[model samples]
Target chain A: MLIPGITIKKGVCQLLALNKFSVGQWLKTFDTIIFDADGVLWRGQQAIDGAPDTFNALRAMGKQAFICTNTSETSREKLCAKAQDLDFLIAEDEVMSSSEALARYLQQRKFNRKVYIMGGQGIADELECVGIESLPLDEGKMIGSQMVDYVKNITLDPQVGAVAVGLDKDFDMLKLAKVGCYLMDPKVLFLATNRDHSFPVAPGHFIPGSGAMVAAVESLAKRAPFSCGKPNTFICLHLLRQGVIKPERTLMVGDTLYTDIQLGYNCGFQTLLVGTGNNSLQDVAKLQRSKLPLMYQQIPDLYLPKLSDLLKFLPSRNC
Target chain B: MLIPGITIKKGVCQLLALNKFSVGQWLKTFDTIIFDADGVLWRGQQAIDGAPDTFNALRAMGKQAFICTNTSETSREKLCAKAQDLDFLIAEDEVMSSSEALARYLQQRKFNRKVYIMGGQGIADELECVGIESLPLDEGKMIGSQMVDYVKNITLDPQVGAVAVGLDKDFDMLKLAKVGCYLMDPKVLFLATNRDHSFPVAPGHFIPGSGAMVAAVESLAKRAPFSCGKPNTFICLHLLRQGVIKPERTLMVGDTLYTDIQLGYNCGFQTLLVGTGNNSLQDVAKLQRSKLPLMYQQIPDLYLPKLSDLLKFLPSRNC
Candidate 1:
């Protein structure tokens, strides 16, 4: 039976049953695919079944696939290593993590400002890869000790022109205070990796994510940082502008709608939602019935129970 | 010349010129006085001249005075010691600090749950004084390291019935996450000492105050702590209910209108704004012209340059 009110093939047509739309149907119109990792390709560190085979089959079909994740902790090399270890066939250059996007965005600008980071070693490594220096990660600990006296002790360096915050284990008052100090100077760029408030670590457990840490800094700084993640479109659009990817022919696939599907919505690309992650098809159907401000949030173009379901959609039995 | 539009007396008559309306007149109505320490009685650690003498004079006039401060770091004994060093004599029992108020608030209920403290030694001392145990101040640090994995690692002691925040010199993420873990129980009391965002350190310098720290925790916990400071009236009224003071016969004096004067407004006590610390006469006059939502922000009942000015209002005073 069809799940009524689902979005597919765009003109607001009567939607078909869930998973009825095939990858062969999606591939007919789209040549490039961008995947959100946590839900689509894998959960935590585990590779979802049929994921690697689907990507391997897509490559055999002369299609391009890229990993576009908001995971700020892992470096590009690490992401590629994880994919390789999981037997997912993807090139290292094809992985566009939020940390890498931040690095590329800064690299494009030739940003000279020594950055103060409120993130993990991945961002530090990426920033260093581009020759943009970031302040010591533990600087928050040292400066925060003196913060009890005055913010004066946590002074901003004249060259520190940007403050980048991502998922960090060391999210503390010192880093937050240092970020607040630099933010006082109006010239500094406040770059945040993403706005995800919480994520599932295990099936039953949820912990505060980067969005929570970013908000703590944002609250004190009285400013919002521009996120370099999915919804921002800076990552994929950067590739599109270079003529490597065409928005009209690209499909953005993910488990979550707000970040993954909205990112596709933002970039004017076709979006596919899979139920193997944070959001499910029922959640989307229920949202469509309610009042939500963002148009992108109300629905996704097409959704499947899992990425592996697309395997059945391939027209060729060889697929 | 008197500052026009200032609040004075019960009839709301134009405030008299400065301290021109003698203490002789203030004594005729308000027999008991509550003082905010930082700006009203002293700036930083220095006491204003004639502050002790005025208190001594009020004592001689058969009046009652109480020190109601939000200084969380200092114990009641320390407050008395500081008063002694400043040449002011006050009974230890009469001192009501935020830490002490929290102690009494917990004591009244006979809370069996151990408390998590995001403050200094004084609150810890005060809690122990009332037979309530507090977790180690650095417990946040120990538990916070495991937060990256899961909030479950930051175990909430079944006995930790409350989390109280104040001006902690060692504010960090670990402490915030721990506080958040305890707050998840919903039954845990979220107690904050005060909500002072910043305080004047010297002539022109200011430091991030306890309010900033409290806000960080409040943001993560998704709740506001019950403030046990001057403006909240929890402390003042707690004593009032015990028959230790009467609101009708009391005057609340402070330098800052928000914390000090608002405390009086909340408790229905006469309020006097002193200029020697912060929120000068000109500042109040400026705020009066602008529309304000809170009644206390409209105007205080009176204004004086400093506490010493009250010495001139003393009856039968000898040079």
Candidate 2:
């Protein structure tokens, strides 16, 4: 079958479309494959056509597959369950989420103090899994009608050693102010789950994401956060350090450019862009024309219309 | 009486302390004066010691004095009333607040459609004063428990032509999301009252300002707001355009450097820094050492211990 909407290209600078000849060669290059869950495998609650079979086929071929997402709204367990529900073979241990990354970061530091959270219950659950305590998410609300009264009456928790921000449904001014006060102590660690500004809810429709909440607190605190999601490089450094994957032999596949592609570039891994999510060939073409060297990092090594398109290039028995 | 904690210095690069010898010459250089409220005039409800007498004395010197503040919490009427209650002779029309500037901006554009506001009632009142209607401030809250439900069920008002943001006590994720949706249309105007990140609430304590709220929306919307307050130049450009004051002959007096001093530099007005608010000589010295040309804009032309210190330099009859 001919791939639609992709021109055959040869150079790494150009967005090369995976054809029968190139796909087979590309499959031999990467021993480990890291997939961005949301846009590559599925969008929202629905899995893309043939995505599950494509993912399962890669695993069946003896290729290591891991699900990496910037979502702070759910835990690894929930993500694994959702992936299983959508027919994609995934395990809790094979998933790495922003919230999970944050929890791991604290655990690595052996941080015992409580954390002030401005996110969903998932963040709290992740922290709890690591035996790290977090303040009640709802306790940050304003104590009175006036902002001054709230500012004057509210007291900062001396035990809070860090402030973690993620996509929050209940984000408000009081929480923003509370985070600001906690961050005033220079010793307090400021962490953000991810910095995806907006995420698509439907075709051409997007909603504010965790980055929006993080930006508010950052402005008030006058400091940038230590982000634990894609493009930060720190998220995937552990895998490289543990010798789980070699940079030259690893392939990072996703639908987003700035996060997935940039992360791949930062980690020295080959990147593949799929059209089922946030970006397309046009975005890559635009980036290719940019004068800045930084833009080149967002360009992918290869392109496919969707994840399922790769299944045809694999052996039928694997599928 | 000797002024405390000031070392006299010369040149614009140096933070020049106001002395008796230079006070008369400085007084004659400007026919009009702009004063920043809050720290310069008062701290909360209490007037800075001898501040009212100093202000009244400056007006008695035949200088046109105006109270310019970035506060969006109250109307011009309320600010004028507060000024009078604090013993300063002021007229309602003499106050140029952030909310007032925003209202005047819409009035100048002859905008007729309703505004979607994320601010205090003061913003709505100011818009009403100019015959423009704004959507109810409290109506933007989330309708359900889930962010997806809120995003799917909530509808954007077609009548809203502009989205105005200020220091909102009730700022939340829903308002941020609603603004994001409205801003998806390229025609909808995005306005911010000011970008003051944080304001001092008490000694060594600060609270999140309107800039915090604006930053969140700006990140989600992926657009910059046309700010109406200090440091934006638009706030005082009207004064220069209407021939109300000559920039060369006007003096901008305040306790903040980023807003008032930068506004003065942008407007070609002489800037005065008083040590009653956010910044001090330490900040000015730090800026002077910076290699960036932009940092020089924040260095004030003159400095005083407090607004009241200027009282000693003026004629007793004026006081």
Candidate 3:
């Protein structure tokens, strides 16, 4: 029996019920496709069984596929290298992460301002490349003498220009107080790097991320911070400004309903979901039951068992 | 020949009018008196004319005259030395500046929070004495560079906890932008080191002071800054907290009608104005037609030619 409210291609409903046609078969109509990493390409130690073949088949059908991830863990080049190691054909630019978007955004600005960053060297290095001075919060034992003054001086100096909020393990009250005081002056601007609540690390645990800190400051300041990374329209607009992708035909695909699907949906792009990522089938069902509903009504236009199953879904090129 | 609104003693009135007994004796009512520096001692240079003779006359009356100048220009040691050079007797603590009040206030609260400053080294040093970190806007440069990134990286990084607005020469659009963005975050606390709109410089020129910058940020953030200088109730409250002076008995005397007189009025102290200072006799006269007509209603209780003349007006110890 067909699941209530589940609409598929007319007459194709019968095909779905018979279990003969998987949802992956609908991929043929689109000339371009975007894939999500992690759950789609691989779960952890092993690659998804059908992903590699599906990608190769899509190429054979004269279709282009790109992967967009919100992961700050790896650069676009590194992501591409990982795909190459997995025996997949992918370009460097095709692998876009929100971190990369943040880096790109900072790169194009015509500002000589020095940045005191809390994020990894990736962000620092990116900022420097654009002629922006980058001061990473130092972490060394020999400089411990200056560290006391440094911590004390953190937000109290008007010379700081701006305080770049990013991921840091050593975050504490002093930092909070300094930021609070510095922010109280309306002349200083507060920018949020991203809005992801958490990023997956291992199977059973998810790490607290930027969204936590952002929420903390937002609650205190009683203002919404301008978000720079994924799902926020800024990153998307920046991407368009860079001529990286055609917004009209661009598709955003991911396993996570938020950050991925909503980003595509909100930006008026087609979205696709791959099972076995941040959310499982059970998690989606539970989300549907929750009172504070997720944007599940804005679900992906297409769904697949895994990234590799896409090859079988594409219509015959001759047809 | 008597001034229209002049209040002369009954006997003095009869003697001066030659309607009664001859002007045999004139009783000087006040002797011992305190003087505030910014408006009373000297505004940016040459001393008030009658300042010296007034003190000398008080001393002649066996009155213990003290020079209390709240000029944060020099340390207690320097202030005492300066007073000596200016022909006045004053102790280190007797020359109380708002800097001292701020330091004491922060110390009492054990506020270890970093203070982003836009003032002189005096403010920075004062905050440091209380173990509060100080970030001077001048030396640290404009914080706008850091602010842009701060606003952009709000979610991913640490936010400024408190913003201290003070006097800075290099205060510009960049500084304003940074401050503006920082204040957008609600967690940030807004403060003004002082609300002095203009600092007296040379004879005919004035530098737009901290109040101007504070006003700029306050306008954007839509909130009044927590000011900690003369006229601001914070310093008054701080003094009260430290048991330095009681609001009722405390008398604030200075030349500037805005800072000195307004402070005294707000703190419920008797306010005395020296005729010559930032607001000259001409400025005061012009106030009669001011846009805010009732502003002049809050006039000083005692108006003297200079701080020195104040000794002649105060009620005598024996009288």
Best by DockQ: 2
Residues B202-260 of candidate 1 have per-residue lDDT tens digits of: 43334556777776667666688888886888877767888777888788878887788
The per-candidate TM-score of the B chain, in the order shown, comes to: 0.87, 0.92, 0.71
Candidate 1 pairs with clashing backbones: B7-B301, B23-B313, B114-B159
Q: Candidate 2 - CAPRI tier?
A: medium
Best by lDDT: 2
lDDT of 1: 0.75
Report the C-alpha displacement of residue A3, candidate 3, in angstroms.
Answer: 18
TM-score of each: 0.77, 0.92, 0.44
- What DockQ, between 0 and 1, does each candidate earn? 0.23, 0.53, 0.02
lDDT of 2 at A245: 78
DockQ measured for candidate 2:
0.53
Looking at candidate 1 chain B, the ten consecutive residues that score lowest on lDDT are B6-15
Tell me how much of the true interface, by contacts, candidate 1 captures: 0.21
Tell me the lDDT of model 2 at B255. Answer: 89
* Tens digit per residue, CA lDDT, model 3, B51-170: 655655555555444444334434456666776677665566555566666666667766655655545566666666667776544332323223333333323113345666665544
